[model samples]
Target: MGSLTLSGRTALVTGAGRGIGRAIAIRLAGEGALVTVHYGRNTKAADEVVTAIRAAGGSAFALRAELGEPGDVEALWDGYDRQVVEHTDDTGLDILVNNAGINVRCAIGDTSPETFDEMFAVNVRAPFFVAQRALERMRDGGRIVNVSSGAARMAFPEITAYSMTKGAIDTFSRTLAQALGPRGITVNSVSPGIVDTDINAAWLRGDEEVRQAAAEVSALGRIGRPEDVADVVAFLTSDAARWVTGQVIDASGGSRL
Candidate 1:
């Protein structure tokens, strides 16, 4: 079997300051990709990730842009362009992982219009625009992996808006794959189940009972870890997944089955 490596490639992973995004950035760097670690507001966490990568003999740098805000996508690429000029002469990218997202859980009755708009803006609009602009600098045979959630496939009325946003991402990936196929670019989505991250710590890690209940949702009988989702994303970003595109790979550990 061939090994997975991203030597000589450049990758940009959004929300890399912590959680799944951080894990993804580190994993890609370990595989030898020159990584751009993006953060929304946590520059320190992002810098720490970059420092760790560089200390491990990998190349990485941190970029900042708050998604869901006006002009966010352009600001992100502006940083990317500047960093590319400073780090390498190449103007193309090899991988783009749209891993940044927000989840606001509320019942249909409690979901306000403001919250609904914010969720869609951050979870759907940001990624869509990011990919649209990224294609211009993405090389042939490059990969785009959208981080989706099991909530999109299963019913989660408590987080209806959040789930809806992920569904949109799945569609975006499928349609984009068809659009970019002629250029040999692959776009896919990776949907994960309940993962133990800062985002879910409030509930999943709050009590043993809650944690175990979350774990039981998966056949593995354990709450998913950020690394679990990150590894799947790494595979999809690698050339090994070149033949795979426009598909939503479930990294959900047999949830909702």
Candidate 2:
């Protein structure tokens, strides 16, 4: 490969205040794209990302939005339109990484309507709306990457509802891929396995027995990291992956088969 340069493009990454979203935002910014770092809460964390990106000599700005709210999501894009014009030469989004999501660890029997609704609102509905609006501004040959999970494929206990949303994202990616292919855009999903993110630190790090069991099941003999999954996402969003679309690649280190 010569180089995967994104010098003139712009990308918006939601839930980019920390963890996998943070890593993906940084990775995209590192490739030379001006980035809009979106967060739901914790402006501090989002600013930290802005500081880190700026300190690394990359262009980035922190923007906030409550993903489940329609107005907030609209402000996210509206803010992006103004930010790009104010900060960078580009005026449109070339990449949309729908990484903002929530996980409700509720089993089938214990699942509540409120819990299920909240999860879907953040994980499924929000991303759908984001993509819908983004399409209007995205140029030809745009890229859309939805962060999915291995749970979507496996029948894991206590996470059935969360898994349902992930499966929905995968299907959405596929359909969007076909719908946008004519426009020279690519849509895909990156389904990460049990990665060592703050969201799962309790089971992946806090419990030694569970940690060991997780590692043993993985071919890599260790837990995955934010960067591990981010690397795959970066590739999918790059020119090298131009021919790849509607595909879900597992960045799980061989977990969940």
Candidate 3:
């Protein structure tokens, strides 16, 4: 909030209707970016995020794209083109945040093939294609932040499929960063630990034992807030991280260290 780090930039954040995605959208808007809040099914939540940004004197809009399905990337950009034309008349985007994902808790023994496929479809396939298509519309020197999970590095046997998907994301970011480096584009992954969002509220809030157990996983001795990860993403998108790319920045509060 001190300086308009992203002033005049246009950002697209997927799965922004709630949870960590919502926090990133708000944070980027606060830094003066024109944000497009993308949601899959929760139109009401998406609208609320737009409303909150507008109320804060920021520019924002909402778009929908059900990721992991056929033509999902195309549908997303179709909306993006119209919105950008109506709002800024700019043809290029400055920031792309792949924050839309799903996690299913299932151990390897009980994991179904269908569940594994769906996880890869949404978490890995969707984001990969989204970046591929977005490259056509992304301006030089743009930033792309892929939302990964600490589970990629740490062992989460209960959610093996989800963890595997995140590992794919980390690799995608690293490889894409090199591919886009000549154009001044930076691609990086931000891996966050357990955050106190609606997604984790079931076990993170109002349950003293559960909350404490989760907190103890991190060196910080507390569960992460949405804003905690948001701030890290904002920094990566800003000029401050201009030289940083092809790296996985773990925003996990020094877990297991």
Candidate 4:
């Protein structure tokens, strides 16, 4: 691919403050897309991502809005519209990465109603509404990538609710792709497994035994990195993936196979 495959395009990555989202933002910016780094609460981390992008000669700015709350989608887009107008004098977006989601590690029996509701609120409801609002601002031939999980396909009873949310995302991608096909827009979901990010640090970082267990889950026999998933996302947002839509591409390093 060319160094600036996405030159002059505008992209927004939710949860861009850190982890896989951060990697996606940086990668897109490096490919010459003006990026909006959306963060929920970590102002410092979000600002740092913007700084890193700028320092790398890429353009980016940070926007903050906690997801899963009342009016969260509107608040996020309001900020996004203003920032995009100021930066590019356009209110349309070229790429939308719905990467923000929360996971609650509880089995069905142990999961409370409150916890279940909260997970759906953030993982399912927020992304659905965010995409609904984003479609209004996305330009023709735009790209939409929802970050999902391998747990959605394989049974992981420990995070049954979280897996359900991801399954919903995959379904959302398929239906939305058909709806937007006339506009040449693509909607797809990516499922990653056992990535070594802060969210998994508690178990995967210090304990060698736990780390090895996680690694062995992947056929590659190694822990997946944030960039591993980010690269897949970057490709989906590029023109090369124009003919690809409504598919749930797995970035799981052959996990469970």
Error of 2 at 139 (Å): 0.8
Estimate every model's Cα lDDT from 0 to 1. 0.93, 0.89, 0.93, 0.93
Write candidate 4's Cα lDDT for 96-195 as tens digits. Answer: 9999988878899999999999989988899999999999989999999999999999999999999999999999999999999999999999999999
User: Could you tally the backbone clashes for each prediction?
Assistant: 0, 0, 0, 0
Which residue runs of candidate 4 sit more than 4 Å off their true CA positions? 1-4
Using TM-score as the measure, name the better of candidate 2 and candidate 4: 4
TM-score of each: 0.98, 0.97, 0.97, 0.98
Question: Candidate 1: deviation at residue 86, Å?
Answer: 1.7
lDDT of 3 by residue, 1-257 (tens): 33338999999999999989999999999999999999999999999999999999999999998999998999999989988878897769999999999988899998999999999999999999999999999999999999999999999899999999999999999999999999999999999998888877766798899999899999999989889999999999999899899999999998876
Per-residue lDDT of candidate 2, residues 158-202 (tens digit): 899999999999999999999999999999999988888888876
Best of the two (1, 2) by lDDT: 1
Provide the lDDT at 191 for model 3. Answer: 94
User: Where does candidate 1 clash, by residue pair?
Assistant: none
